[model samples]
Target: MWRDHLTQIIVFAVLFLGVSALGFFASRWRRTGSLDHLDEWGLGGRRFGGWITWFLLGGDIYTAYTFVAVPALLFAAGAMGFYAVPYTVIVYPLVMFALVRLWSVSYRHGLVTPADFVRTRYKSPTLALLVAITGIVATMPYIALQLVGIEAALKTMGLVGASGFGRHLPIMIAFAIIAAYTYSSGLRAPALIAFVKDGLIYLVIIVAVIYLPYKLGGWGHIFDAAQAKFEASPAPNDGILLNANNQLNYITLALGSALALFLYPHTATGILAGRDRNVIKRNMAALPAYSLVLGLIALLGYAAIAAHTTPVLKDNNTIVPALFDGVFPAWFAGVAFAAIGIGALVPAAIMSIAAANLFTRNIYVEFFARDASAARQAKVSKLTSLLVKFGALLFVVLINPQFSIDLQLIGGVIILQTLPSVGIGLYTRWFHRGALIAGWAAGMGAGLWMLYLVPNPATDHAHFGGSAIALSKLGLDTPKTLYVGFLAVALNLIVSTVLTLVLRAANVRDDGDDTSPEDYVADRSTERSSLAAVASESSGVAASRAAS
Candidate 1:
């Protein structure tokens, strides 16, 4: 099998190496005066135009997981996997309202991470630390998910062994290349490489969607084959259509995931890289084109079933790669695998940069070095990105892939806890800082406990089985299942609301906000004055401390 796939391996290597070279050279793409500044190194100098922003955000959002795991889930479960499609669709309008405001305020205040905004909004270092830590923890498994995508591709090409050191050596090597480029180029690396990654993915998906259906008879036969397989299986809920048992899970999962998607630090990293609020608004309108591509890609799960392509490693993630290998020519299969591999790089780089930015801005700057300069912050951020990527590598090497998936689901749950503080706090300061912190704690605790009780029989794991919880598990007798994140966030809202009222009535002091109402509406052209003012204040404070 390895010898037969020599052509595919060659093609994958050429494309992968080509992108790594591009990533190294990306530092010079925009030709900044200084790469030492945190804004330049961590955010591509915040100058991405409409088209660049479109491709960068598209690449950041539609990841290798979209290419591999979504289809894998579809292949294994049927209609339930299509939740990603609706989730992507639901996320755009929501972010259109939410992120534009976040961009304006971040640009105005020169904030580098969501936690930076949280700190300024609440004037609470502890709350910001919580937000920053949650972001870093949530993002680690997500980065591991990307590595899982590349591992699936490598496994499909027979480049890695079934177990032991051989299995992880190739993954580590790939991560090392990513870590090097990201350390050098930071956000620019991913923004530049996204063009190639998105282009290859578009080409591969276009060909697969058009050619595979015709080759396998038609879409009709594809669905027919999927239904036949599900019917023959012993599983109770395995058909191509949604049943009453899964209806609530489908709706709640889509809603919860959509709410949590942009809350990830990587998504905010991409959004903050835009040149202005209009760049964000335009990208929001245009970025949905990738969702259209995603809808078509989801059909490949059915295509895999129609082709009767047995997964290579008994892993569902291998289903898509195996489908390409079975249906397409060797060279084209190689292209598909390369697309999946390179797709991992864009999001991995962004996620690491985002996590590093959170650590540098929120933890380091806020706690250790309140007087740290931009150059020093950038240095810390660069080193932190390398550490974050290696942490993700350890996650992939040490944990079961299914467990990583569950951890990512819990990540979404954890990240959603921040919406009350970061997302809603953008518009209103009514929720006290103490209330927001308590709310986050409630949501995170409930989410973890719920995930711990759900069991996966296939893996024989008694805890952290999956994101879906039976309604019966929550004291209802029905067999229906719902997303754990949604239920957790509901409890989060209740706690925050009740606490906000109690705090207000007790005359508790909420930290005064640093931002004004006008800041949320500020555009790039109007933001410089505020940025300059903040910089002057920070310098003065540093000098005063030095004099003392």
Candidate 2:
């Protein structure tokens, strides 16, 4: 057993060291003179051209959890997991509609984070804080899932053990390495590493899709094997396609997830990191290539069935890695492992940094200390990024790793609740800011409460449970099941709209205007706005020149 895993351990060591070296050296790759500014640290100088932004955003959005979980879900529960593929496909077009405008306004106004947009758009720091908190909360578990992916890979290579200290050893070291470079280089590190991460992932997936089907007697056999297994299962959800009861749930979840994807702070960070509007447009047009890869990756779950692969970890989340081990040579397996391992680091670091930027810019500077300087704010952001990474590490180590992955799904649902405040607000200022806050409160409560009601099939527990809402469980339900995320978001929009109208009727004042039509049309060349320079300048100059 130990010998079988020795090569994987060596591979991991090499790759982690390589990534760490890259992270440590990233500031030089896109170096400006001052490294202590938000532009250099937080948004990677807002200077990534088309190709870099494509790989960086691709690496950030398509994560290690995706590499691990989508196949694992397909392997365990049949076709339900294919939801990821459709969601990814639909998301780019949905984002394409708004991303250029988002970049334009953010760039023109020197917005560092999405919450900064919220603060300016609605002129309400309270609403901005709500968006920031939701983003951080939604993102923490998502980062933890990256550790879960690493854990799955380790377990497949027979590298994990139940001895408390030993099982956590690799995770602790990984976290330390990630946190070190992220603290030092900030967004630049992840932006640089993303090229390697996405390239490796595309190579691994391309090779696996071609090689695995051949070894298994072709794609037809793979599909036949998967179909037979689900046909014989007693559970109703074991098939590849949704039933009549779940059709709405599937469609709504896909759409809701698409809507929520760009609202994520990491995604916004990637969008803001682009060099110009054309880069954003070209990247959006190109991102669907990754979605195509995602579709093939999901098909690997069926390939697992054809190969008769069993789940390697204590839970069923290790299907893809297990498939890799069973079907590929040991050295190639190590490459696959490294692909997933590095993939996790790219997004986790970006998410942590994005969350930190939100806190430093919107919360700390907005409320507690209005007089904080840019250097001090950058320092605070660096420290906050460390804390965020540590918090994510806690979830992976202290909680069940399976539960952590489950929480990422819950995070998606949670993030969707912010659609009204961030996503819709990007397009229109019709919703009263106070109504937006009320809507956020109501949506968050309902989403959490409904999430609390979901029960894990394995443990039959309350929290970190399945998001599928059983129709029969609702008593009055006839024959339709619903995704908790869809229900929650629907209720969120309903409340937001109703409250907005009521406030308008009551003559409640709207917040000051922050964005104009021309502002949304401006790009990098048209506007030389620097978030760092503006942060260091007079607040009155910044505010009065824009909105205040």
Candidate 3:
């Protein structure tokens, strides 16, 4: 067994290390003498052009978790796995609608974090602090989920055992490499490494879809086999088309996930890093290519069923790894494993940077030391990035590796709370800042309660139980069982809206100080002179060319 897995270990270490080196050196790819400013470290100098953004966002959004967990869910539960595809498909248009405004506003104000936007938008540091804290909390588990993907891949290759520190060793080592380069290079490293991450993932998935089917008999046979297996299952809750309950879960999770996607701090890091509105638009338009790949990858679940591949471990998370093992030569499986392993690095690096930015801009500067220098702030952020990665590593290694997947679900709920502040604030000042705060608190409270009530069968925990809402708990006669996150967010919005009217009627104070009413509608023509000044603040020409 040791000899069988040794080749994979060596390949993964080499590919992963090479990717880390690329990330560390990426700091030089778009070098500026002063890495002191948030522009340089936080947004990769806000200058990635269309091609780089596509690869970076592709690597950012479609992660190792997508590669390993989605298929595993499909193999284990059936149709629920494809939720990722629709969510990715719908996310771009949603991002396109709000991102330009966010960029213009952020550019105008020199906002480094989403909390900076919230702080300025609402004119309330407390509210912005909540949003910042939520982002960091939500993102931590997401970084860990990438590690879970690596763990699943390693387990399939027989590199580790099911329990104890042995199972965690691989994740710890991966996290160490991730933490090291991220500490040294900041956001540029991940942006540079994304090219390799996306290229490998694309090659592996494309080849798997075409090659696996031929090896497993044809497309028709694969479909037939999958249908037969699902049909023969004793559970009524099986198959691709969600029943009334799963359908609601599917739609809500997708929509809620789409809304939450860009709200995550790392996503904000990517969008703000773009050179201009055009780069943002072009990237948004082009990013669905990853979604196309995601749709193809989701079909691999059906392929797994056709191959009659049994998951090697106690859990079915090994479906994709096992499928590759069954069909590919061992050496090729090593290459596939490299794809999954390196895929974790890009997002992990980005998330670490985003979290560090939040701490540097919001907490360190705001409270700890208002007079801190930019160079000192950069040093603090760099260290914080390493700590964030290290914390995520501890979560995976100490808790259970599987918990990261569950925690990621919870992260979605936590991140969704930021939408009314970040997403809704983009188009309107109608929401009273105080009322918005009230709304966020209510939404976050309810979302957590609902998530807490749902229980996972595998772990016997309640609250975020499976995606389905048990109608039995609600005590109503309805076929529509909704996603907990959707319901919680709805509750949050209602409470916030009602409170806004009351606050307005009482003539309570609102922070209309930070942004002007006309600022939201300012296009390139009206805003050009002001925009040019903000763009020229530092490293303007190099930033412009890279973005161009």
CA-lDDT, candidates in order: 0.88, 0.82, 0.80
Candidate 3 residue pairs that clash: 46-273, 451-463, 451-464, 452-463, 453-463, 454-462, 454-463, 454-465, 455-462, 455-465
lDDT string for model 1 (207-252, tens) is 9888998899989999999999888876644589987899988999
Per-residue C-alpha lDDT of model 3 across residues 30-95, encoded as one tens digit per residue: 866567766787678777888888788878888877877787777656787788888989999978
The deviation in Å at residue 332 for candidate 3 is: 1.7
Output the better candidate (1/3) by lDDT.
Answer: 1
For residue 500, give model 2's deviation from the true position in Å. Answer: 1.5
Backbone clash numbers for all candidates listed = 0, 0, 10
lDDT of 1 at 358: 97
- Mark the regions of model 3 whose C-alpha exceeds 4 Å error after superposition: 397-405, 517-548
- For candidate 1, the per-residue lDDT at 238 reads 56
Question: Model 2: per-residue lDDT, tens digit, 1-548?
Answer: 65777876688668767977999999788776566888788888888899889888988999986788888778777777788878888888787868888898898898988888888888898888988898998898888888778777787777777566878776777788888999999888988898888888889988998898789999888889998888888665657766677677777777777887888899999999899999999998889988888888888888988999988745677888888888888778888999988988899899999899988998899998899988888999999999998888887766673534475678888898888877887788889888888888888887788777777666557564767776666665576667778888888888889998999999988857778988888876655566556666877687788983
Ranking according to TM-score, highest score first? 1, 2, 3
TM-scores, one per candidate: 0.95, 0.93, 0.92
